[model samples]
Target: MNRTTRHLGHRARPVLGRSGVALCRIGWLALALAVPSARADDWLTGAPLARQLASPVDVAWSGSPLRPSLERLARAQRVAILLDRRVDPDRPIELRLLDAPLADVFEELAAREGLGVTLCDGVVYVGPPETARKLRTLSALKTEEARGLPAAVSRKALARAAMRWEDFATP
Candidate 1:
C-alpha cells in the first residue's frame, strides 16, 4: 500500500478490527447527510434574482412622474434591478423592486391602469399608462394609511399597500 493507505490501514486496525468500526460508519453517515443539507441551503440563499423571479405574482412595478420606487425595493430585498428604456422611449425607465408587498402593489396598480406588465424570471416591466396610475394611487394611499398603523406594522403594511398595485397590474 502507498504511504497514505498504509497509514490508514494501521489506523483502521485498532478501530475497524474492534467495535470502533461502528463509530467510523456513523461518522461517514453523518457527513453524508450534512453535505446535502449544506448544498440545499447554499442554493436557497445564493440568488435573490432567481428567488424573485420564481413567483411572478410576488412582484410589481409602478411608474409615475415621480420615479418608480425600484431603488427602494431593491434595497429592501437586496437584489439587482435591471432597467431597460429602449422598450418605451416616451417613458424610458428601469428599476428593481426588492420588497414583495411593494412589488405586489405596483403590479396591482399597473394592471388597473392598463399598463403592459410582464414578469420574465425576475425582471418587471411597467408599461406607460399603468406606470402613471401606480404613482397616483400609491401617493394617495400612503397619505391615508400613514396615520392609522402602528410604527412597525405601519412600515411593513405601507410597503405592502404600496405593492398592492401589483395585483392590479397586467400579468
Candidate 2:
C-alpha cells in the first residue's frame, strides 16, 4: 500500500496513495464550496434582497450607460455589485420601472443587456446570462439548505408581541 503526507495548515495529514490524494482533494473541494455558500447566507436569513425589492422604487433611465445605472441601483439598494468587464459598461440602457420590485428591475436589465444577474455573499453580480443562472441556482440551494433548520432548543425564555405558548413552546 502506497502512502503520502500532506502538510495542511499546522499539521500534516496522511493519504493512502495517488487515488487517496485525489479523493481527498475532491472531498476538500466539496467542503470548501459548501462552507462559503452556506455561511454567505447568514446575511440572507432576513431575506435582504426580498426586503429591498418588496419596497417600491422608481427608476427612470434616459439611455444612460450601464455602469452608472448599476451604480445607482447598488447605492439605492445598498448592495454591492460586481460588474462584468466583458459587457460594454458604456452601452446605452433605457428603462422605466415605476415603483417596481428590485428583482423585476434586474430582470429588465438582464433582458436589455443580454446579461445575467446573481446574488452571492450579499453582493449582486451582472454578467453573462449563464453566470447569472448559476448564481440563482446557488442561491436556491442555499435556501433549500436553510429550510431544514436545526431543531429548536428544549428550553428558552421567549417573548413576543403576539405571544402564545403554542407559538414558541411546540415540540
- For each candidate in turn, the TM-score is 0.27, 0.52
Q: Kindly list the per-residue Cα lDDT of model 1 for residues 24-143, writing each as its tens digit.
A: 222222222222222111212225544543334343333432123443444445433322332232342333445444345444544454454433212243445444323223333443
Cα lDDT tens digits for candidate 2, 41-152: 2223135655774567788998898877776666556644557656787889889989876656776777777887655434455778785555434443433343344434
Candidate 2 lowest-lDDT run of ten: 1-10
Clashing pairs in 2: none
Relative to the true structure, how large is the alpha-carbon lDDT of every model?
0.34, 0.49
What does the lDDT come to for candidate 2?
0.49
How many clashes (backbone N, Cα, C below 3 Å) per candidate?
A: 27, 0
> What TM-score does structure 1 among the candidates reach?
0.27
